[model samples]
Target: MKARAVARVLGKHVVMIVLMMFWLSVLVFCLSRMAPGDPLQSFYGDAVQSMSTGELEAARHRLGLDAPLWVQYEKWLSGVAQGDFGMSLKYKRPALEVAGPLIGNTLILGGAAYALVFALAIGMALICVRYEDSWIDRTLCAAGTVAFYTPAFWLGTMLVLVFSVNLHWLPGSGAYRPGMAGDVADRMRHLVLPLVVMVASHVWYYACMIRNRLLDEVRRDYVLLARSKGLGRRRVLMRHCLRNVLPGIVSLMAISVPHVLSGTYVAETVFNYPGIGLLSVSSAKYHDYNMLMLMVMLAGFLVIVSSILAQAVNEIIDSRMKGAERGGV
Candidate 1:
């Protein structure tokens, strides 16, 4: 029975991932076709504002832009299945080539930002729970609430002003220091401001969620029972309350990863970072439909994977809780 349940859950997860990928593929394709820009004209918009009838028709035929929507989508799907999302007319290169590096950049930024935020949040939550209603707890709560409402773009501007413009501690607003070195230190320096902005945006949000959860758990029956047996406050909170609140936090982190990844678009473009969000915006403005589709697929994939992780964490939590209940532990 256990094996069957596991198999069933895995099967459902796989099916859901496939469905998400398919839906995103179709949605991007259909919407790209629905866009008002003439792909053929936009393709040559720089070269000619006005074209003879024969030239216009030839360009349309070559690019197949005048085809029926369904036919165009079908052709696009066929190319996608073969791992060729067509070429970017503007860039004169494969879309995957353009998307690959940008995705790499995004993952680096997202990973650093989330790691710092999540680690600090858990620690802050523990501190808040340990102090309960003390002055420190109250202060953290007030500060976290304010930070939660703070905008990333504004935060980026402030960081630039204080650290870069005023103090000259870091570069003002761009990804890399121009023409210095291509080494790790150079990359780290470039990443600092954007990463700090993202971390600031996320830490308060996570700390608030975790602190609330831990506070709620610490007041529950299990925690009180643990304390009644003479367990120290640290032991009871860490071994019992924190454990119970952890499942929820783990699930939240899974959801937040996708949110941070997609929501970084504005931040990336604002900061002039060479990440997927900015790249997607550039591709989109230049009518690089292939690259646009790639970004859509990448975001869809991240969401689907996060959903699976959340589901798996929930399963483990429920199983453990049930075991503890049966044992009266």
Candidate 2:
């Protein structure tokens, strides 16, 4: 019976993801087709301008762009169903092939930043909770608000100018120094500025949420009881309040995936980092339909999956949610 319930839950989530992806694909396809730009420019570069009308038609036919919009969508959908994403018009390569390494780079950058942002947020929240209404908490709150509102591009540019251009302390762009690709330390040095921008832009938002939650937890009856039992303030906060609040924190992190991912993309573009974020910008600018379609689909899928997984985790962690799910089932 338990196994059956788990299977049912899994099946429901799979169906939800499939439906979401289908609609997302439809939306992306229609929008990309309707957007202004000559895809031929992406494919043929400056030569597209020199092509005669007849030659241009021939080129379009060769690339299957001469087909009607619905017909093209049908062809593209069928190809996607079979795990073929088609060729990238700009690179003249298989879309996945071109994006594969970049995806790994993005995962590395994004994954690290995601983990660090949460860690720092939680740590800062703890410090604020410890200090409560003291000057430290007030100072952090002010700094965080300013950092949260700072434009990521402007922050990135300033960091580059100061650290890379003036101090010569860190390399501003790219995933690694060209020949030092195998060195983890070299890669980390390149990661520093982008990571700083991502962390600075995101850490405070979550920190504030955590601080509020922790403060709320501190006032609960159980905390008062714990304090009455001669438990130290730090012990009660850590052992009781923090533990109780962790499940909500998990849910918050799951909800934050899309937000953090968007910040990652912005950081990537600013740094010229060879990641899916940079690829996304270039693909959109060049009207590389196949590449754009793949990136959009990948992003949408991740967002949907993360939300589903967060709900599942919530169900597992909170008995109230589990009971609710079972009753609904």
Candidate 3:
């Protein structure tokens, strides 16, 4: 029975993801087709300008761009179903092939920044909770608020100016120095500015949420009962309040994946990091439909999957959620 219930839940999530991806693909395909741009320019560059009408038509036919919009989408969708993402007009390569390494770079940069942001947020939240309404708490709150409101691009640019332009302390762009790709130190240097931007733009928001949640939890009747039973404030918070609030924290983290992912993209663009974020920008600018489609679909998949996983985790962490699911089922 348990196995059947789990299978039912998995089946539902799978259907939801498939439907979402179908709609997302249709939307992106239609929008990209309707957008004003000559995809030939992305493919042929300056030569596109020199091509005669016959030559242009031949080129379009060769690239399958001469087909009707719906037909083109059908063909593209068929190719996608077969694990073929088609060619990138801009890069003159398989869309996934061009994006594969960039995806890894994005994972590394975004993953590092994400982990660091949560770590700092959790630490700061604990500090604020301990300090309560003291000067330290007020100071952190003010700083976090300011950081939260700061635009990512502006923050990244400022960091670049201060650390890269003026002080010459860090490499301003790319994942690493060109020839120093194998050097972990060089890679870390390049990551510093982008990481700072990502962390600053996101950490405070989560920190404030956590701080508020912890404060509220500490005032609960159960927490008071724990304290009345001769528990120290620190012990009560760590053993009772913090533990009780963790499931919510996990839920919050999962819900924020999309938000945090957007911040990572912004950071990537500002830093000129060779990641899917930068590739997405260039693909859109040049009307690289295949590349754009892949990026959008990949991001959408991540968002949908993360939300599903979060729900599943919540059900596991809280028996009430499982009961509710069972009742609904």
State the TM-score for model 2.
Answer: 0.96
For residue 192, model 3's alpha carbon misses the true position, in angstroms, by 0.8
Which of the two candidates, 1 or 3, achieves a greater TM-score against the reference? 3
State which candidate has the highest lDDT.
2
Best by TM-score: 2
- Tell me the tens digit of each residue's lDDT in model 3 across 220-264: 998888878888888887777888788888888888888888988
Local distance difference test values of all predictions, in order? 0.80, 0.94, 0.91
**Clash totals, every prediction:** 0, 0, 0
Question: In candidate 2, which residue pairs clash?
Answer: none
By TM-score, the candidates rank as: 2, 3, 1
Q: C-alpha displacement of 62 in model 1, angstroms? A: 1.9
Worst 10 residues of 3 by lDDT: 315-324
For model 2, how does the per-residue alpha-carbon lDDT over 106-156 read when each residue is reduced to its tens digit? 999999999999999999999999889999999999999999999999999
Residue 148, candidate 1: Cα error in Å is 1.9
Model 2 stretches with alpha carbons more than 4 Å out = 318-329
- The digit string of per-residue lDDT tens for model 1 on 1-329 reads 99998899889888989888988888888888777776654468656467878888888788777788788778888988899887777677888876776677788778878788899999988998899889999998888777767887888888888888899988765566667435668778878888777776678788888988988888889778878888898888888888778788888998787767855676687688888888788767776777778877877888789878987888788898899899996
Residue 237's C-alpha lDDT in candidate 3? Answer: 79
| Candidate 3 residue pairs that clash | none
